[model samples]
Target: MRVLIIGAGGFVGRHLLPNLRDEGMEIIPTGRSPDRLRRLFPGCPVQQCDLSRDRAADWLPRLAGIDAVINLAGLIRDGAGGFDDVHEQGAKALFDACLAAGVRRVIQVSALGADEMGTSAYHRSKKAADDHLASLDPEGGRMDWAVLRPSLVIGRGGASTEMLAALAAAPLPLRLGPGDWRVQPLHVDDLVVIIIRLLHRREPFAGRLDLVGPEPMTTDTLTLTLRRWLGLPPARFLPLPRPLLALGAALGDRFGFGPASRDSLAMLAAGNVGDDSAVRAFLGRPARPLAQALARHPAMAADRWRARLLPLATPIRLLLAAIWIWTGIVSLGLYPVEGSYALLAPLGLTGLSATLALYGGALLDLGLGLALLLRWRPVAIGAAQLALMAVYTALISLYLPDLWLHPFGAISKNLAVAGATLAMMAMEAEHG
Candidate 1:
């Protein structure tokens, strides 16, 4: 059977594509990035489509000759209010298009806790889409529509899984408040298998079903389990006040680092457990246990190290940026100008020339700090920083060699800083 899979470039899509390909079904994968989709599903028909922004009529032509449409398109959290567009209006458009195209089946991958009175925007939007799709054509029986509302899904490359894994990799013990909230974790592999079975069955399955694991786990237990899976020692954790966490999230949202907003906190507060009988009935067996799933995909040291170190980049960049910005501020007004001139005078910089050099260097430092913090041309910024440090060190060594032996180790410290800058540049180049 030919199928159209929207949002086929996401984490779920990454797993689903390979599995679907193995099933020998003709697949049409569509998403925002045509290049990425092409790479992921080479030799298969791939279409560039954005459900949140594009017109439904535009996607209709592509839907032609497609037997089924599986919408895995969704956003966990969005700062730009794109969730409503993608979840509600986007699903509406796709449903209309599917009906018009006479598509035989449509499967919507929604989340657990999706209801009319959902607490979070993410859940509310998902519920709105589910309701809209469920309201169509029960009497006529024209389309086979199925909605799978799975609880927390765990798999390699999943955003939520990665986040948890990274947290588990932390150097010190990590605490996420009381962590009493419970969730029935579902394996992505299990979910995919169920979908495949449903697709192959002669009888169509209609209505919403919860796809969850056989056992429920509390947040704290889950966290500790993941930590043990990563081969880490027993770590202590302290409960954090919900209000304090919310305050931090609000601040993080403003800075773009914090994707975990109040909505997510709300969702966490409400628990994410569901009945798994439907999933078991479809799978013909009980769902995979959390321990078994974790054991099956044993954690690698390299992955753990990468996860642990990756988060350090932000703080390191900020620290380095702050150093430069502070240096600029001091050079501009805080530090006596006479001392700056005295230091530069040895190198023949005097009068207007010395003033220009001092102020100009300060401005350059300020600009570099801002650029680094903003992540504008990160590779170039890293390269520039290395070059500047090297030049400064050379000039200092040549002009005032005695400073190298000073107690503060001002000139010597540049060696380490330059190395860090070089490492940053190297990392950026390799990753890019």
Candidate 2:
């Protein structure tokens, strides 16, 4: 059987492609970016289709001879415009095209808590699409549609899972209000098996089904489970008022950095859970427990270290930037010129030359710090800091060798700072 997989460049598609290949099914991956799709699914045919813009006529030609269409295309975090365009309008356009092309089967991977009266725009948009697909002509029609609304899909490679892991590995507990809301996280591997089974089922399946795990867990318990898996010590949490958090989320939304948002917080407050009967019936066994699923894939020392450092990345970067800016300020005018000249004189700098060197180095430091703060080319920033530190150490050793032996150990501290900077770079390269 040939399957047309939309959003094949996503987390689910990355796993689903290999599963389909193992089952000896021909795969056609489609996404907005042809280059990315090709990179994700090499040696496979890829088609470019933007759900936000394309219409039924645009997709009709691509559905030629396609046995089934798996529309796994949707957004979890986006602006309202993006949510409406991609989820609601996109689903209608694609489903209509599928009907027109006489595609026999279609499966939609939706979130578990999707509803018409969803607290978040994400849920509302997803529900709109799910409703549209279900309302399609079922009687005397060629389409056989089923929507799989799985709870939190936990996998090693998914972005959400990574975020959760990072949060769990944090030095301090991140308390989103009380962290009392519960969720049933389904293992992605298990979810994929169910999808493959549905594809090969003798009788076509229809309607929406919740694919959740065996047990429900509070958000606090979820974090603790991941923390335990990563061998982290128990951490304390400081719960702030919900209104304060909402304000912070609003600010974060405006600045594009904070994790919490109004809708996201509301969604979290509401909770995400569903019955696991359908999942158990389909798998012929209980769904994998959250801890078991996590322990199945052991995390390396580097992975653990990476997780521990992920939370510190932003703060460290800002600290380094502040150091540079402060140094620049002191060098510019705050520090006595006589002392600054005394330090520069040994290196054969004096008068205008000394002034230029002092101010110029200060400006360079300020600029580097600003670049680091802005998160512009993190790897390059780390490398530059190391190079600058090395140069300063060498110059100090040659010109004022006694400073190295001083009690303060000012020059010596750069070694640890450089190491920290390297760690930051590593985290950025991996997750940035």
Instruction: Note the Cα lDDT for every prediction shown.
Output: 0.81, 0.83
Give candidate 1 regions above 4 Å deviation: 39-44, 345-348, 377-379, 398-400, 418-432
Q: Compared with the true structure, what per-residue lDDT tens digits does model 1 show for residues 123-160? A: 88889888888787653278888888998888877767
Per-residue lDDT tens digits for candidate 2, residues 1-432, read: 999999998889898989998999999999988988887788899999999998999999999999999988976556658888998898889999998999988998988888655667888888988888888865415578888999888887676676677778777866657788888899888988988988888775678888999988988888888777788889886565688878966865664553456667777678788899999888999898988987888777766776666557678878887887788888888999889999999999999999899989989888888888787887898899889889989999999898888898878888888988887787677434
Judging by lDDT against the true structure, name the best candidate: 2
- As for candidate 2, its clashing pairs are none
The TM-score, computed over Cα atoms with residue i paired to residue i, of candidate 1 is: 0.90
| Model 2 accuracy (lDDT, Cα) | 0.83
Clashes of each: 0, 0
For this target, which candidate reaches the highest TM-score against the unseen true structure?
1
Instruction: Give the clash count for model 2.
Output: 0
